[model samples]
Target: MTEHRIITIGREFGSGGHEIGNLLATRLDIPLYDNNLIRMVAEKLDIREETARAVDETTLNSFLAGFIFEPIEESSRLNGTEYVPPLTQQVYELQCDIIRKLAERGPCIIVGRCADFVLRDHKNCINVFICADWEDRVERIAAKYDISQRKAADKIKKMDRERRNYYESHTGQEWGSIDSHHMLLNVSRLGMDRTVDILERICR
Candidate 1:
């Protein structure tokens, strides 16, 4: 049997990362695990999908600082704390587990969630980071969300900040930095099809 190709993509907000992943998955005839990963985790863990989405691919904030100091075994004791919810840690762990399992299953494209770091040891893995110019990103977000350019830009800034903090906090690596990925592509430069072609070639 041939080893499956695994591609992990990390992208700046509104940089067409999800679209690229979808296209790549279609072109390669593999599953695209983007937001669906969150849904799967939520279902497996019996948690609300919204809760899963909130923390999905996102790092815990200072709000979780106190809990991290507590022993993992004793985490259940703090179930009722006003600052932390019982399912927070459970959801996070389930998400991580799902990511690992998906990679083991076969060829797939995983977008976001520090998947590159999670599967760093997988020999067949190829990690790519997608970014674009601020203006281009703003335009993409505006069109997708049907909001004004200024509002879109603001949303992009906020989302990217959260993603960066989440990635850095959990993986201890710089988000969108070249060091974190095998290839860094500016989606604006070559567009999605060319980017996918480039990645497919590199992975091959």
Candidate 2:
């Protein structure tokens, strides 16, 4: 905490990244930004939280872009031409701005939402990527959601794909590439409590 480090955590689905972030934040006495960002973006755009959540960590399909986003106003048109960005893209830009401001403010932890890439230039930023064994992830998801293993596996695949697409599209980097992060952790092996302890020590 002496250096006011900014920690950005990226994780595979069901890897306990958010929970780890929450624990680290509590131990470090710093704020954590995760789903709370969805609310902030929702308020800024005057849209429902659900609407923001729908596009929070996914890219908008080109074919459905027009249907999902309204036309741009004449004054707001790019070079007098209709050039509306997808709602997902707009939300990302807004989130990037907000993330930058938060990092500038002080030490904190930001989970997912491509925060690592967003704060890449920050001098004290520590980017982490968390992954786990497939079976471990499946069990975690099933137990947490009270769903069948098959259903949990399906959800995990879908969520990870969306997160991968979103991150690659915006950052032009592999989602969990070792080159992109300062640390690559296997939470299943470390255990959530041990993972939190390690990260807390890193922050300190």
Candidate 3:
């Protein structure tokens, strides 16, 4: 029997990362995890999916303000309060747990939320980072969402900032940096199909 391979994809905003992940999953006949992980965390924690998605792997400067020491473990509980210091942390842990459980199930493709860092220790893991030119990304986003170019640019900037900040906070590494990935693809130049083909060869 062949060994199972886990592919973890880290992508930049406005890039066709999610679409490529879906295509790869279909081609490889494996489960694809992107939005579903957020749902699972929300269900497990009994929080709204929107809320879970909002804090997924993200940290706030306010939460880290003026604390030279980490909080006592005993004080960390998921209370139904707006000021809870542990809410985001709990969500992040839940997401990580879900990612681990998914990997254990079989070969799968995981997109975003720093799955590469979470499953780095897995022996058969393939870490891929997807990026594209700013103009190409902006155009893609605009076309996909039927938004103006300016709107697409704004959305891309905000989303990338959130993703970058979240990744840096959790993984202690820069998001979209070459060092974090085994392979980096420029989807704008290679296009989606060719990129997928290259990744299939690399992962195989």
Candidate 4:
């Protein structure tokens, strides 16, 4: 019941969580951040957007940090080969810094990339998880992307898996677990506008 100024939304694939975040930001007259943060990370790291996105919200970030790169060993073996932290590690660390800075700057809506965990200490940040029934998720994704329900379901499965792995790896918490969020919203039931309205009231 604290006055939450920054909002972080963790959502299942195709649950309209992104849409809800955007609407909430608009209504609040604040910036909304999603994939845009990826671009920022990409630019800061001097890597292609596609490269940064390749590891975005996936276990590869941590996996590659410890396993995929043998830069230290390789450096000793090869002699004078500069060692850099894996790009995934850089992106994760940099993204965390960005998230914290954004929280400090002002109120805003941020979606995914483990923003909830990044700002867990913030006194006025609300972490929300958005979810929907599978059938409902498939319908929403299908309509939004103009794809068949079957394909939409497949897409949802893959994305949800990646996000789950990413969040669990970074936060040490189960993605979408009820305890992890201040509130769990079923956009399937509340719909986007009402969802925004409720969150808006809560943000007050």
lDDT of candidate 1 over 1-204, digit per residue (tens) = 227789999999999999999988888889999889888977885657776677665554635322232234435544566343335565556677898888888889999988999889888889999999999999999999999999998999889988998788778999988899998999889988899899877766
Off by over 4 Å in 4: 1-4, 60-82
Query: Whose lDDT is higher: candidate 2's or candidate 4's?
Result: 2
Clashes of 4: 0
Best by TM-score: 2
Candidate 4 local lDDT, 1-204, one digit each (tens):
334499999999989899999989888999999999999987886777887788888864354435333335333333655665666677788899998888888889999989999988887889999998889999999999999999999999999998998899888999998888899999878988889999999987
TM-score, candidate 1, is: 0.86
Tens-place lDDT digits, model 2, residues 77-172: 678677767678778888999999999888999999999998887889999998999999999999999999999999999999999999999899
TM-score of each: 0.86, 0.92, 0.86, 0.87
Sequence-dependent TM-score of model 3: 0.86
Residue 153 CA error for candidate 1 (Å)?
0.7
Write model 3 residue lDDT over 65-108, tens digit each, in one string: 32222234425444653343466777677788888988888999
Worst 10 residues of 2 by lDDT: 66-75
True-structure RMSD for candidate 1 = 4.3
Rate residue 128 of model 4 by lDDT. Answer: 97
Candidate 2 wrongly placed segments (more than 4 Å): 1-3, 60-76
lDDT (CA) per prediction = 0.81, 0.88, 0.83, 0.85
lDDT winner between candidates 1 and 2: 2
Runs off by more than 4 Å, candidate 3: 1-3, 60-85
